[model samples]
Target: MELRHLRYFVAVAAERSMSRAAEQLHLTQPSLSRQIRQLEQELGVVLFERTTTGTALTPGGAAFYHHARLLLRLAEASREAAHSAGEATREVVDLGIPPGLSPDWVVRLLGLLRDEVGRASVLITEANSAEQLRMVREGRLDLGLVHERPLQALTGTRLFSQPFGLAVRPDHPLAARTECTLRELHGLRILAHGREQVQAAHDALIVAAHERGVTPLWRFAQFSEHARSCAEATESDAVVLTENSARRLLPQWPWLRLAEDSVDLTTWLIWQPATRTVVTRVAEVISGLAEPVTVPR
Candidate 1:
């Protein structure tokens, strides 16, 4: 019921053990149990299924867990807003990232921002492109790096757009090929990322098969995870990724190869116009940092 209860609940759910959660919270097991019991009573539902193995969320508990996370994030945001003035003089920016960007890109960009801005606190949030855009629009994030074009409903500055390509393992049969066509991919498997728009794009590719309408087997993955996983595992024959993302992964792995033909995916810096001045400055810093990322043809 209280903020502390939500905090404890989140800890317990995340750790999956009351004792571990208690230890992390610097509380005794008994106190943690009491807090959980009180929380369950207030909610009128059991939030966790306790067993010898550990605590696991029931269906209702799983649903409450999502809301609990959102509440905690909002609480942190509130504190940031309350302490805004003191921190305004300090340069700290929170950047949200969508799928398709390599984690290395994030590391490189964070270092770039810190070196350029000086004395910056950088926070990263990874989500689907749509969700990342929504957070920027909601004023919950200073700026977002998305793997798609800017939405008409939102105003944003362009970062870069890279060509999308079919990614495959080096040893795979398709790796020997120089170029591959969407229609030629009939009966072959492919991995795809994103929600709504990206999903629709993937579906379009599958539906556009010239004949036989062969469905490309899909393995759902979140932001760079899927492409990397499928490529490493050799699970699906290919995965759709931006050229920057492909090149980012290829150097280290060396086994993942890209087909010559590629689609274009754009990365953009999205923000709300009505955002506060401090947040606006943060966005400006991010936009400047991304100025040189070339959009692939």
Candidate 2:
């Protein structure tokens, strides 16, 4: 009827003597005997037979002993499993990253996270900023790196800012210049990422080029791989990208900063407001890694 009843029944059946079981259980002989009698009554079965030598099991007592021992073992195993579950020490954090980002930066961030959160595992997914923002809003991703602050109910922090630069083939005339103005890129065919892939950055470049009175014929591709293929096939005059990404993604080409100071690119770290503590800690590490560096013009 109860766990204690099963335990008492098993102990009494094992020792075959009321006094011995009582001594082992730290219960009075009368108390232990009464408990065993109550168990037999509840089951309507005779268990132990009184004997002049020592108590002996009746036919029913032998059968009950087998199941009673199993029940006690199962209960102990269940308790241990529950306690282990409550003390779980590891956590997994899912992070989304934009494509064409600097690999070196990502490696450094991952290393820092591993060191700081020893019990945390990181899962990385590559997606564009706009897509990453949508995934974070939908609760599919715990954190993301995006080009602009998300307009959704999520929280965001600025990670770092980079200047826009031109990537061109080695033989291109612009490759020889250390820097060039947006206005000077006019009349040249250029390869650019699609508006949907990086909405904020793409729109900003378009608006800045328009304000500078430059209207290059722009060829748009939806993904970084496609944009790179287009640039190689068409031998386009140049492709625009952040200085860090340009150097890592297309190292064969030369990267030249845009002479216009206003053409800066910024990256933000975004996550759901209810993100786990591990994700928040990782965000802090990223913010610390974003300190500015001075580069001579």
lDDT (10s digit) by residue, model 1, range 61-88 = 9999999999999999999888876754
* Local distance difference test scores for all models: 0.70, 0.80
Off by over 4 Å in 1: 1-91, 169-171, 194-223, 226-235, 243-261, 289-297
Q: For model 2, state the Cα shift of residue 47 in Å.
A: 51
Cα-based TM-score, every candidate: 0.55, 0.66
Displacement of the residue 164 alpha carbon in candidate 1, Å: 1.8
| Candidate 2 TM-score to native | 0.66
Among the numbered candidates, top lDDT falls to 2
In candidate 1, list every pair of residues with a backbone clash.
164-263
